[model samples]
Target: MTVSPATASAPLARTPLDRRVEPDLRVALCAAICVGLALLWWVRGGWIFPLDDAYITLHNARVLIEGHDPNYGVPALVGASSLIHLSLVTAFSLVLPGEAAAYLVAGIGPVLFLAGLLTLAQRLSLPWPEGIALALAGLASGTGQFLNGLETGLVMAAVTWTLVLALDRPSRLLALICGLLPFLRPELGLLSLILMTRQTWSRLAAGSDRAAALRAVAADAALALAAASPWLLWNLAATGALLPRTMAAKQAFFGHPPGSLPASVVYAAAMTAGGIGPAAAALLFLGRDGPGPALLWFVSLFILGFALTNREVLAHNGYRYTFALLPIALFAVMRLGAARGPSVLRLLILAQWAVALAVAVAAPTEIAAQQERVAQYRAVAHWAQANLPQARLLIHDAGVIATASDLPLTDLVGLKSPDSIADHRRWTAPSNGAERFRALDAIARRSGVTHAIILDDAPDHFWASLADDLRRGGWSLDPIETGSARGPYILYRLAPPTDPAAK
Candidate 1:
């Protein structure tokens, strides 16, 4: 393959403070370098920092690994499911157990995601180095909630590549895989359907075989429906609708007195940009495309629609929920820089990598610095995992607690209520309000939750309300030990005996 001049200098340019190397091994070289950088980021800040939503996925895997049915409480709530992680749990269950398997799975998921994305770019006729650059761009951008510890990165990569392959060949096997996309992430699956529908409509308008297009559409839809059947069935049984997993959380948030569109917009913007810079920049540059600019317009509208509807902005920000549109964003960027020489394109790509590396390196210690004030909350999480019987403990902040403790959280308060479970499918914090708190307490009691976890950051928040309720119910707050600068986390255990004299 002939290398473009612009692409050649990208990795070779010397920075005064940063090391640089020109890639020569083509795909292998580019991929290896990118993987090395990701590893550096993962090791430097991510390894110890705890992935935002990784704990929930890890918890689910742990359940299966431990020979227990991996129930993250979605079955009884609003009816949502994650077959991809469930499958991982089953695979890990065969040999590895507990945190051992969970960590491996968690770490590998992102790599797979990056690979799948590169595969998709290849299908689009992008050269290997270009594809690698795009994949790295996706990772660094943090769009689609890459930094959220949600499995969106991998899941999106899988779904996007699946669609690309499906479109290129439209094979039964590829179609089948494409159909199962919804099983990995429902929102992305729905987005796939929408994009396919648009494509099919265009084909029909162009005088292609209508019957064939109809068949293709039907096949795709059937596969999607079949893949989603588990959740649909669960929802029918639980909530009487094929709604989000946490329908209760959604109702609670929407019904809040102060909640409205303006608030959602604020949350959405924060989610779109919070901590993840490259992805955000890609999204902003999506308009710089072709003669018709059809793809650009389509993606922009798609994301804008999602933002308008998205309610609760999650902790990992809005990475997962918005990840479905990232491929289009990347494609747009690729096209924008296509006119520039290859070296310049590679340089831009290298710059993105540099930024991601800098951000990740700074994140760990910066986050550690703030851990002291949040120590009490982390301590309680540790105590709950150690002392209390682990029968589906419910927590407000799934990432902060579940990832740190390597414990499974049964129910997250606001996962489906506009926050999108793509981050922490098993756990999410409730939106602000008195009703939200009451709902959290009610769910804890009804679901037979063994323990409740709380942080003192917000007095009127769900954690505070749960603490007050537990205290009234005669529960004692015990301190738990933790690592690093994390403060004392208070575990609210149900009081032992009514009579102190009995002891």
Candidate 2:
């Protein structure tokens, strides 16, 4: 049997990565990393993340903890983009309160991600300095999401370990985990395919057991399908779709075509290029010797998938969708071992790490300030809870408000509300006020919404514009009158149509 060059990177049939280091010490190091990052963000900033989306994830955890159907005050819809994180936080919250549980789970993401990078670096035997820099760069790139209390870190953790297993372990267990990747986040599902392809190919290239490798790949695929079956079936049964609506909602919101490449090309490129860390991660792939081209392939496919799906807004929410690419790039670096490229490559790598570290260090205060701004939104939610306890509320600024109050909610952004969830494409399309008006009006009427609580930046123009067409004359303005925040919002008493004859 002849071994191809591709087999050169294959792991020895032994446990690797810090294998020489004591297990207890490794665990201690991971814990310290998790705790250190958590304090660096939360103690300096605040308990909550700066973004409203974090609270949306938190809300799902709370609902699960309370044993309610996972809905944002409606049935047949799960509000969170990541059910995996939701379930994890819910499980964690059973031992701790929802907020603390969420915080702990969130912190675990970066730690797992860092540990993964270090493990891979050790397995591949990269220089210690480069390994640490690469690991920190990956962590820093996603610091916002890790600290924000969302599933970005979990997604990274999952991807890292999946890669680790695929490259080093290569078993049926890995394939099964890959199968559940989409439920974690849609991008990971794509990664699952790419990884399995590489893994299967690598085994074939080994020339040791062609028949056994083929059988193993088949078994892995079957296990993955088995792992993923429940989610797909449940979604199809409940929502008439095989995939979650969250992706569709976001694509629509950003005016990304659900099926296209031409229109999305520039946007997707901009999204990919927007972050120095993610870009540098891909760059690391260029000047290294590797048996396979997994990272490059995945990144290309990711951008292509984004274009076809029209999911730009890459720079949104701390580049949440793109952050996974950072750790993945580092993983590629580990697989390829240290770069033997020009000195410029090393300097550029160091520069990427420095920028990422600076952003992460400064993020706490910035995030805290942003949360302070959201205080008004929370205040408004509290006001509605106290004053209009029975208000069937239609709300913008969905996240913090949903967590802050129990006033029945119909997310004005259509992320949660049953009436509005599928209407994102219709409303978000490049259309005039009338089209968006009919969309929102239908949601308001369908939900039997008596009042609306819309909070936006300063004048609250975006939400206000969406509500403009409704016959909402003399609606209450600034109902709560809280301190300076992102915005002071309006709670409207949506009037019945002024013209009785006009339907």
Q: Among these predicted structures, which one has the highest lDDT?
A: 2
Compared with the true structure, model 1 gives a TM-score of 0.65
Candidate 1 local Cα displacement, residue 258, angstroms: 4.6
Error of 2 at 81 (Å): 1.8
Error of 2 at 266 (Å): 3.1
Candidate 2 structure quality by residue, lDDT tens digits, 1-503:
11112222543333344454424444666888867866764765536567787787777667655656422644333556666777788788788766787778888888888788777655555544665666767777776678677888888888777766755656777778888898888677777887778667766777687798788778877888898998788667756677777776655554644434665765776676565364344434533334246666777778777777755557777667877676666655454443333243356557667778878897877887777766666777787778777777777667787788777777756677645755655765554233566566666666777777665544536555655645442222334443334354666676655553333
Give the lDDT of residue 29 in candidate 1.
44
Error of 1 at 133 (Å): 4.1
Candidate 2's C-alpha runs over 4 A off are: 1-29, 37-46, 69-77, 202-211, 257-263, 276-291, 332-345, 430-434, 458-464, 467-486, 500-503
Q: Which window of 10 residues has the lowest lDDT sum in candidate 1?
A: 4-13
C-alpha positional error of residue 272 in candidate 1 after TM-score superposition, expressed in Å: 1.7
C-alpha RMSD by candidate, in order: 8.4, 4.9
Instruction: Give a tens-digit lDDT track for model 1, residues 123-181.
Output: 34345567677676666554323433345655656755554553343444554554566
Report lDDT per candidate. Answer: 0.49, 0.65
Those runs of model 1 whose alpha carbons end farther than 4 Å from true positions after fitting are: 1-53, 62-81, 116-134, 141-149, 159-163, 166-174, 202-217, 220-244, 247-270, 273-320, 339-354, 364-394, 397-437, 440-451, 457-488, 493-503
